[model samples]
Target: MQRRFLVGLIGANIGKSLSPALHEDAFAAAGAQGYYHLMDLQVLQGRATLESLLVAVRTAGFAGVNVTHPVKEAVLPLLDEVSPEAREIGAVNTVVIGRDGRTAGHNTDRTGFRRAFEEVLGGKAAARQQVLLLGAGGAGRAVACALMDLGVQVLHVFDTDAARAQTFAADLQGRFGADRIRAAADLAGAAWQAAGIVNATPIGMLGYPGMAIAPELIDTRHWVADVVYTPLETQLIATARRKGCRVMTGGGMCVHQAAEAFRLFTGLEPDVARMHRLFNEACARRDAKLAAAG
Candidate 1:
């Protein structure tokens, strides 16, 4: 019998997510039967809680599900097991349902961000050896861990919730060393001294439309990256580019992460180049629709 897999994405405001197309197309290219569903909490309208959805999907024989945004951290404790990387990052973006009917949480965000940075930015952003990371949330945690893996000398983190930023820095300090990471109380000061700036918050995303840091804080000396892919060209990215700063969009991260998730789901290697092409096509369609609507 041919192998088949059922996977899904669980998050809010995910109606326009490109994950389904990305993973399903990869499965098609690999000649496997695959179905990717979206469990959008906003769309479900209180019909399901995160716990309830996980139970439903597991019971329905789902191979696994990808967790995102608000639920990435929330889904961690609910899993039967968590990979070391995910545990270290304190977030989980991908979950695998084992044959023994147990769920294991893993994070592809770290590898995804690492690949995107090396491939898209050509590692130029890390040249200064220091980076300013905005938002110490789930995505921020993943990126922070990736930066350490990439050999960043210093990471200055700032979050609207100062406590969250300090906590994230403290957690990473245990792994990357106390001198390598610090929580920043002044975003402008950190951005001024860093080689790159990363926005890991939802500020630049579709529902939340704004830059995490002021455009004035960005300069040619800085490379800016945002994890908000829906807009493709967020205000932060555009501002950075206009200022002659190298900018990496969230699209590359999204595609790379989905490619990793596809591998986890199917145990088969996916053509990442093909996935990137599909992602670009999807983004073009979304942009055109937004333009026509305006």
Candidate 2:
């Protein structure tokens, strides 16, 4: 009998995620049989309930699981061990369960972020230019560290939570140095001073509206990137494109991360081009659904 594989995403507000479709398509393209499920854990509030659900998933023979949002940090404690990257980022997005009941946590966000940055900007985004990062949460932290590894001269970080932003800034600075980091409460005052801008927040996601930063602040001289890929062409990316700024969409990061996860489970390098095509088709389907609803 052939072995069956199962994968799932655990977190709230994942109904809008394209992960299921992407993974399913990759499975088909690879001639593999498996089901990728979206598990909304918001219903299982508190640590006990979440742990119970996780324990159940492991027992049910799931190959692995993907963590997102509110659970990235929460899932850390539940795992038996974590990768150095995940530990350093203080977040985990993928969890693989061992047959002996051991769980290992890993973060693929940095790998995805770096690939997307290099693919979109070629070699122009060197380590000597300032980066105006507009979020300081899990996603933001991963991308910031990825940027530092790529030679970012400075990272000007910000978030609505001033304290959180300051803390992340200080942490990165301690590791990367004071000469390469600065935390800000907001970007309203310093938009024009950076080489590029990145949005790691949920603003401009499918159900969300508006760009995290004002459109007027974007100009032809800057490079812009957003981690929101649901609406591949987010309001921020659209506005930046209109202003002649080079823009990077989050879809690349999404596909790359999912690809790495696929490799983790299947030990095969899936066709990225095929994955990209399937993903674009899925996005189009989603857009049609949204249009019909409106």
Q: Rate the local accuracy (lDDT) of all candidates.
A: 0.91, 0.84
**Candidate of highest lDDT:** 1
Provide the lDDT at 23 for model 2. 80
Count clashes in each candidate, considering only residues at least 3 apart in sequence or on different chains.
0, 2
Model 2's alpha-carbon lDDT is 0.84
lDDT string, candidate 2, 180-265, tens digits: 98997558655777889999988988767788888888879989999888788899999999999899999889988899888876
Tally clashing residue pairs in candidate 2: 2
Error of 1 at 57 (Å): 0.5
In candidate 1, list every pair of residues with a backbone clash. none
Off by over 4 Å in 1: none
Q: Show model 2 residue runs off by greater than 4 Å.
A: 42-49
For residues 92-162, what per-residue lDDT tens digits would candidate 1 score against the true structure?
A: 99999987679999999999999999998876558548899999989999999888877888999999999
lDDT of 1 at 11: 93
Q: Best candidate, TM-score-wise? A: 1
